[model samples]
Target: MNKWEILNHAETACYQEEREVLVRGDRRWITALHYAFQDDNYLYLAMDYCVGGDLLTLLGKFGDHIPEEMAQFYLAEIVMAIDSVHKLGYVHRDIKPDNILLTADGHVKLGDFGSCLRLQEDGMVHSSLAVGTPDYLSPEILRALESREGYGPECDWWALGICAFEMLFGSTPFYAESLPETYGKILHFQEHFEFPPLAAAVSAEGRSLIQGLICEPQERLGAGGALDFWGHPFFSGVHWATLHHCTPPYQPTVSNGTDTSNFDVVDDCLSRMEALSGMRGSQPAGAHLAFVGYSYMATGETKDCSRDTVMSTDKQQSGDSEGLIRDNLLTESVSEELPKPFEHHLVLSKGPAGHVHGDDTDLDAAMTMELHRQLQEAEQRSRGLEEEIRQLQGELESLRARRLTELNIHEPHLFLPAHRLDATGDGKLAPPACHYPLVIRLHRHLLLFHRVWRPGVTGESYLLVCAAGVELQAWSRQQSAELS
Candidate 1:
């Protein structure tokens, strides 16, 4: 029941083990350091230990707003570290200030992967059990526990955006009275910032980069897509390759620089990640790939798809801290309420062949302000109505799917919502009642299966129904009750 002791022991063990493992890079550079014990309740982690301590401690000493130069250096370093971890095919699910450590020599060392998992291997959507600090969590993460079974690399990028925002501003963009409220704000995409301070301090391009990083996963940059964001105008003069080469940007706070007493355990633990990365490509020929879903491209496969063109249906949104979907009007309304510099701009590409879009600059500043106010009020009203409509639509879809799956109906046209039969006593003809009734049919040739889900008035329901398997006979609740 006492978690403090457990946490302290785990934290100490992780710190100690990481101190000893130095091959090409330290534990900070090693994202997944798997260490288990004979007892196996908690695993020891030998990760990179920066002498300066975590970002939380640093913030306490110097306040939340970091120096611009230091912030840029720290942000850039973290981005590269993230790139390395993701390349190895994993996501550091819990990214926050407390996880980032500053070495004695003034360089940033990203640590803590206790919540880390091989994102490519473990396909999750979101978790109900909250992990990591609230302020630093992505909108999706904040809502889902770290266990939800479907998010991809975009989740990590969302966390990185929060980190960057915290580095520049003393406060987080999203916060509320309670965790549930905070989650609601994130789900609704309600985030705001003051212009006078952060705007005065950071560059236009730097702000743009932040916007790109914080958006919805579909809107946010991908792991490989991140390189382009880093190479943008914000970091025009910065050299990333040279920076990554520096083993230690600053001196480690540990007094003895040559300390190797703990190296064996650390090195042993770090090697597991190396083994995992190596083994990923060595699957047996014609290996059966598990089908999680079609949305996640890496997990599921389609026969006609080309390697490069197996594009994902979901597009990540930029500036989304929680990795949740935003109302299109929320951004527009917020942009109108804010000043010109704070206005949201579409990150469109140039050239005849590229994505080109025009800015609404023809209207005078005064007229624009008036238009913005009108738009915000109108959007707020529209979003409220839209939310109700969406909820109703979702409920209707769920009812239809449940009816089709439960009855094992094979008619594709019957699945259509518009044509769906109203079975709610609205004078609709009820099917002839019979014993063991409700015929079901499915394509046995289609071996593929997907997890079936239904949300009810009480809570969500889940059933892993097979694509080919249909329930031929139903033992109704009345029959079961009579048997009992």
Candidate 2:
């Protein structure tokens, strides 16, 4: 397969896996996946747009650490989120602050399940891949990679411990400059993990909870379930049953449901990730069948109710140039299949009605028209760039010609050698005598001038100029001989 096909295949596999994990419907603490679909070259997942951004952004707003009470509020919700995932027999192998999203009301929602894996019948996963943030990775996960063993959901609890420490202490407990050092610290956490003196303000109960979570996997706090942490002193006032309904310790300031002010705008374009090497070659038969049953739709929603609203709002908020560039990029991404009419098949449908309302035919038509228009604009831009490049090249050649004209006018002697061509008995011009080394110098000067002043001119043209000069000299010599 080509790079584009390889990327599409790898992304489709990931999309299918994440869709399977999230198609379970809306959970209070988990980010809800509203819908999913795939075109010829792209996969689309419409999920909840958390206005308050991720926990990492929230921590940055608070100078990298929050008060113990605020940490407890968010961590409690994260605990429930992890428990929900475990209940479904999947392990969230890559839990970190960046994956923890917050709603406008400051409630936590776990997101980004690209690394999620379902447990086998043994209630354990046997992957050798150490799939998680370096500092938050449990020692058992690293050991599993080395020993080719299995690990359970307890690794997530270990990550929760790292999150707790960072929330209170402003850093992970086992962080090091290098991956090996970080793994070493995690493996021997008894000597490496210690609360700093600067964290004196953190309560003893908070430290105890961190200790319980960052301990051995067999002794981790959430081994039983999220209910295991209900009695922890750090969560003393928390009502676990009604945590989502209760008021949070803090509320993010957002003007609208689509506001992204809480998040950092990293780039105006999507990332161009390297394609997977393993997918290079002809795809196996029925490879597309793997994503056959991956379609889903939420109940009571006739269409993507938020899509148009969000797009219009973003257009209004962003500059016209930026929006145009973004639209053109998105158009080019799927332009490979533009020659053929696009088709979408909902192989599987969820919800009580088992189908979506409204006519999708009109929607597809409208989307196709917009894509064609954007593609046209992108082509126009490309043509304009090519024209600009040609103009620059022409101007450069003119400048070189002007420089050569000035050199010829002021330093004509540079083109001549202190040598005379001799005539043979038949009156044809002969080569300059080898004793005149200046002939070589003249040839070098002529070559440099030809290349710099007229790069498009051929060496044959230079030879013709030399031949004409030689013929003139030979005619003068014949006339001198006739006079004698």
Candidate 3:
């Protein structure tokens, strides 16, 4: 398979993870997943059609900001949605305006659980990858990657704070031109975070809510679940028992259930990019066993059995004497063509006084001898075919191993001097120091590399490589140039 096909498989796996989370149940705030199935090289998820579009689109409709009242209405529902996920022992690492989908009635339904991870017994999850939007990523997430520590559901609340900030103001609080700068601002948000004078109209209560959510993990809101937000000043008048029944501050203008007017349309073509590691070949045997229990039919629903029902009805309609005679004749003809193992026991002809004919006895003996010879020949052919198949399988395995070795040898990596290896944490080999020009291009499915540089905040040069639609950090320059 090509790189794009491999990426498509990775996306399919992520959708499978999302399906697992969505199949929990039909909650008011969570999007409903109706069914999931896989076709050739593709996985399909049938979910709720949110005709009203998403919060990001809604933000665009309002010129990038919304009133405090509207923000409160949506924020409350989002809290409930996120709380529902936490109750199921999963942390939604990716929570932003784009994922908070709107219905035709404009109420929020949280979607996209692809970045979700189940919490451990200690109510925390440990992962090194920063798996969410850079603008809204929590400081703890980035810290965990370097510190090798664990983070809990508070990360989602921090994203909620980012969403609230964007809604009140026009953009995320820690957004910067570069990812490192944004991450630096988030790590030290106490100094970097502040409300702009343009958003002076925001109420004290709304500002307090944002502050509570965006604080340190121990002090963040919703630690004790949705109950923690019940008495908050921003949600003072919200009916906790019947929030879904309350009227929304804004209603979407959708003419039908499948309207695409509220969403931005983009070209559906796949982009050219390198495939991810460990996903370039055919999956191992029994790989499909992972999804054995994934197929589900909801309660009170019945599976379609139209094919079986039609076959049964047809049999009943054709239950006539002529049909029975025809079936019997077919069975008899088949039996006559193929020799039975016990055919020698039957004496087909007898003399007038019930004595067996000598000719019939001789014919039965000859037929038995011929059958034995044919059976031995068939067994010999089967053995030969099995031996040939085993040899072919051995050759196939050897080819796969050799191909993998070649790929590893040809894979691109930055060559750094031995002294620079100490710069990495844990005393392991590291990429070269930053401030070198690096260029990456894909030609004939092979990655071509060159050095490039960008100035960093520390007044040092840094290397950044754009590959597979993601910016990757590369090591510094080396005196000896090596292409392999």
Task: Name the top lDDT candidate.
Answer: 3
Give the CA lDDT, 0 to 100, for residue 405 in model 1.
70
Candidate 1 local Cα displacement, residue 208, angstroms: 1.2
lDDT (C-alpha) at residue 228 in model 3: 69
Q: Can you tell me which runs of candidate 1 are displaced by over 4 Å?
A: 1-28, 31-36, 39-42, 46-48, 120-128, 142-149, 190-198, 223-225, 245-484
Cα shift from native, residue 200, model 2 (Å) = 2.0
- Maximum-TM-score candidate: 2
Q: Write the per-residue lDDT of candidate 2 for residues 1-484, one digit (tens) a residue.
A: 1234533546323454577778772346677777777644445678878777888888998999999889999898889889888888888888899999876556788998877888899999888887778988998999987899999999999999999999998888887789989999999998888999986799988999999999898988998787577657777766564465566787676555578798887895476544423443754555556556666787754332233324533554454332331233233222231212222211111224322211244434654776797799999999999999999999999999986665322222233222232233353442322211112221223322331232453322122123343444455455556656
lDDT of 3: 0.68
TM-score between candidate 1 and the true structure: 0.45
Worst 10 residues of 2 by lDDT: 433-442
Write the number of the candidate with greater lDDT, choosing between 1 and 2. 2
Question: How many residue pairs clash in each candidate at the backbone level?
Answer: 39, 1, 15
Residue 117 of model 2 has an lDDT of: 80
Model 2 off-target regions past 4 Å? 1-14, 273-285, 301-484
lDDT of each: 0.48, 0.67, 0.68
Give TM-scores for every candidate, taking all chains together and pairing residue i with residue i: 0.45, 0.59, 0.58
lDDT of 3 by residue, 1-484 (tens): 2323534455323444576688883346677766676533444566667767899999999999998889888998898889888878888889999899986566778998878888999899888888889999999999998998999999999999999999999899999999999999999999999998885699888899899988999999988777567667777656544456456798676544456888875667355544333543755555445555656544433222212222332343456232331233233322232223323433223334533333235544665677798899999999999999999999999999987664423223444232232344455543433433233322223344344433453333233333441222222222223352
